[model samples]
Target chain A: MEQRLGLEASIAIAEVVCRCDVDIVAAYPITPQTHVVEHLSELVADGELDAAFVPVESEHSAMSVCCGTAAVGARTFTSTAAQGLALMHEILFIASALRLPIVMAVANRSLSGPISIWNDHSDVMTERDVGWVQIFAENAQEAADLTIWSFRLAEDRRVSLPVMVNFDGFILTHTIEPMLMPDKEMVQAFLPPWEPLLKLDVDEPISMGPVGIPDIYTETKQVQQHLLTQAYGPIVETLNEFAQHFKRTYKPIETYRSDDAEVLLCTMGALSETAMEVVDRRRKQGQKVGLVRIRLWRPFPFEDLYRAVGNVPVLGVMDRAISFGGPVGPVASEIKAAFYHREQRPKIVEFIAGLGGRDVPLSDFGRMFDSLYTTGETGKIPAPTIIGLRE
Target chain B: MATQSAKPKWTELAVGTAITVPGSARQNRTGDWRSSRPIWNHEECIRCGVCVIFCPEGCIHFDQDQPGYPSADLEYCKGCGICAHECPTACITTQEEEE
Candidate 1:
């Protein structure tokens, strides 16, 4: 009834999008993400998928083209990684602000200064406030699932917001894995043809992206924020609907072995799965350590995260990106802020790991759990540990 | 006059409430910024419709009820006078707005 293939995650994700029957795709390729657009172009050329593959000169034009195509009520898709996603920064906010419902796959990569192209969360972390619903994938199958579901969640009339699906560069994007490929009829039954809420039809004209004057600017922004916050309900609903049709379960937060565990390690992107392995190994050694894999990064899933870490005294938040001299890393800082008004908040320890595409071994995760337990026992948060640093 | 317009609360406004109506910007009274206004003369005008083509704001249209006549919607025409300049018959002229 289904096809299982040893396909690279990028190709697999692109195949899922092709099945979604997108109307237009415009993308500029960057390392570890190029295979996705390359395959999509092949599909379009071969007439396997009836869609327009616009060849843009740069990532800015890529996103701008997506905006133009989406404004016309066309189902649009694009993929980029690292610097390319950064280059689309100006239009990224505009895409969400205009509510274009464009879906993108960002192969998570480290940023420059030293000019390295590799896996990390620095790119997406730098864009945390870009107003798009962001989600991370921990493995090849998850990458395939989320890329398909991004279109569903984004185009939902209730949400009508752009979505960014982040999968780790090389770690997940380049790996070949056996993915459960949903057939065409199955996808069609799962996702209906997108009915646009608003469009650029000449017969029924409407203005879009007109200047927001001082009188209405604040209210416009308030409504946009409200929509993003309200979108969480529909996001969960669509995921449930997706599971019913495809039979693969997904949650905002995926927890592993946190039941009655004293200390919890939390992570995002591909390293989350590795952290779970370490948690199991540490548990065998008589340590009460477990993990919380944060799948939903934006619309921050505060309630689900808090529930997953329920009654755990301490949390080691592993952030692949740094905030540069801030008291804690980005994910760690957000966790603390989420706990600020809670009745019983766990003591959060910032663990900055895997910057600039450096290897983050299971040993580092184990060490982080050890430090978290010690700090909780001593009742003192350690001065933000930079794990696996040469220092 | 500005205060007469209704301000929508964020909760009341639906998601994606963009200003989408074509030509709706004319309602904002941008014509109030006019330094000059164009006067149209019917006598020397050839009905070539050249002025309609050159209008910068695209606010010019011919009224079918008034034949040989191009008219401007005074509410939106910024009075830039490109229509007057492009008039072959020199039937239109720009006059300064009175304070």
Candidate 2:
């Protein structure tokens, strides 16, 4: 049975992890991400969850421990934030390369220098090429649901890659929202015990993560790349299976009132909810504006994004992270590249907003929509605008 | 001995490129990288088995023909000169490879 309860998103996510029957929870405590591991430790300590709670000295060790445990066929998990995620950088690549299906919840936060402990996509953007299956959640409910889904998607035989569930630090992690909490039985039925395709066993005596010499290194990378790219099909199939079992539909790219519109605003994470409200307000004022929220960030849903945009002439892409000297923001750059070869594509206006825990109020979204409407008329894509930047 | 076989295609590689076969490291002949070979003077050799113990690759062993004299298995010896340096009797010497 499922019961609705007002729960902090981090705690909710921890509960979902418990229901998944994770074998090991190895993590270091970082702000925003701290509560998640904290609650998980409590669950293990209080005897509510039967699992090994490894209190690692650092985030790097946390991920390294997950790799070892998962290699031995243990359903492993971990969580971290900005600097912590960065600390786990090198191991993140090894986890994916070794095909360890470890599940991680990243409380998306900004990187340092003029140091900040606030929410942003900077942390995740830094590891964009780490080869993990990354996804974003729009709210607490989605965060909790996606955490469970991540484990399923990652452990699939055809897609044995680690999965990172990204939800804004503080904003989504600390906020309390009413969500239908599914019982252990429900989650068990939806996600069966992980059946690893290969594991480290003394009886079988197989070696993992061996050295690839020059002759075989390229072939090894080619195989890994092929597996990652082809994981798209398995991701969709797993999501579909979850939807059928849980009665909650989730798509790679979710659209709100974008079936027929002249302009659309693209966003990810919790900001998409605010964007949805802005779309509603704009529609009431007789403007054909809608919203496009990307749920999948890696093995990016290029086809779904194209199908969602349809013939919309203008698109306002909101990014929470800057790509420095390169193309304004990482998300916008990807969107541009996805449509580069197309004969017909939307004129994308990139907007960098809500960085470093800065508030992205409804009015900020209103300004983006207004700028998008102007771009629709002028047909000139302006420079990437930094929202609420006083300078 | 490590033999070089034709590399497997990307499609033929196992999942995660895991070497499913245990002890596959033996297939890589490390001696190919050696620039010098070790020459043992059996006359001064003490048969203390010091060279056999000091060889990094453990390629040195008591010769079957000589009963106790140590000989290097050139196939796997990396010519690291550890045996020459560690030989207490100074019986082992290193010679530069010509080919």
Candidate 3:
């Protein structure tokens, strides 16, 4: 049975993690990500969840503990935001290289220089090559659902890789929304007990993450690269299976009314909801506009993206983070590279918006669509624009 | 001398490059790397077992036939000269290998 409850996204994600029956929850508390581990600790302390709750000193130690537990065949989880995510950068690569199935929730927040603790993709964008399967959630419901799906995806034998679930800080983390909370029995049916492909055991000793000398270093990296690339199939299969069991469909690239659209606006995370609303207004005004939201950040979902934007003359890509003097925003840069060789591709208009927790109002999205319309007519790509910039 | 002849292909490597075998260090004979070899003058040697204790490889032991006299097992010794350097009775000396 499913129970509908109004819950904070962070708390809902924690509840989903508890239902997954994770063996270990090792984490350090950071803002926006604090509520998740805090609730999880209460669950463990109250005997509602039987798991080891390691209160690590720092985010680096948290990820280190996750790696240790996951290596010993324990289902492990952790959560962090912004600077905390940045601190775990070193271990992030090691966890995936060693093929530890550790699931993490990153409440997306802006990185510091001027020191802002607001929602943005800067933290995750900097970790693009860390080799973990990254996914973004639009709202509370998707955040909870993806947290559950992340465990299944990570523990899949065919795709034994770590997963990071990203949801906007404060926007999703602090907001309370109605979500269908699946009971323990349903979660058990969807995700079976984690059966590790390899583990650290004294009885049958095996060395994991052995020193790859020059003779074998390249070969080991080649294997890891191939495994991550091939993991796309398993990810899609897992999502399809989840849809069948839960009766809720999710795609790597989700489209809204884009079939006859002349200009499609693309975005990720909670901003997509606002973009969708803007698209509706434009459609009402007889403008052929649509929305494309990226759910999967890694493995790039090249095929799904091409199919979603098929023949759409203009694509307004809204990025939450800048690439620091690069030709376009990080998300837009990837999109441009993906379409570089293709003969039929959209004229992508890059946009950097909602930086350092700045609000991206409906008017801003309206402006993006207008620019897309102009680009569609002129067929000329303009310089990247920063939405809502004061000066 | 036990070095593997053919390395496994990338496809054939174990997941995460985990080594499934235990105590594989014994299979690698490091003696071939020796640039010099240790020789013992058993006549002046005390059976204090100091050389046996100081040999970095733990390759020095009392000669089976000559009882208390310590000798280096050339099979695994890298001729580090640790035993010669640590010999209290000055009974051990290192000589450069001909080859």
> For each candidate, how many residue pairs have backbone atoms clashing (under 3 Å)?
5, 0, 0
The ten-residue window of minimal lDDT in model 3 chain B covers: B1-10
- DockQ of predictions, in order shown: 0.33, 0.59, 0.44
What is the per-residue lDDT of model 3 for residues A2-27, given as tens digits with 9 covering 90 to 100?
Answer: 89999999999999999999999999
Residue B53 lDDT, candidate 1, scale 0-100: 89
Shift in Å, residue A345, candidate 2: 1.4
What TM-score does prediction 3 earn?
Answer: 0.92
Candidate 1, pairs of clashing residues: A206-B20, A206-B21, A207-B19, A207-B20, A207-B21
Can you give the lDDT of residue A53 in candidate 3?
100
Q: Model 3 off-target regions past 4 Å?
A: A325-328, B1-6, B29-51, B61-99
What is the Cα-based lDDT of residue A212 in candidate 1? 66
Query: Which parts of model 1 have CA positions greater than 4 angstroms off?
Result: B1-5, B12-15, B31-99
Candidates in order have lDDT scores of 0.87, 0.90, 0.90
Candidate 3's error at A103, in angstroms? Answer: 0.9
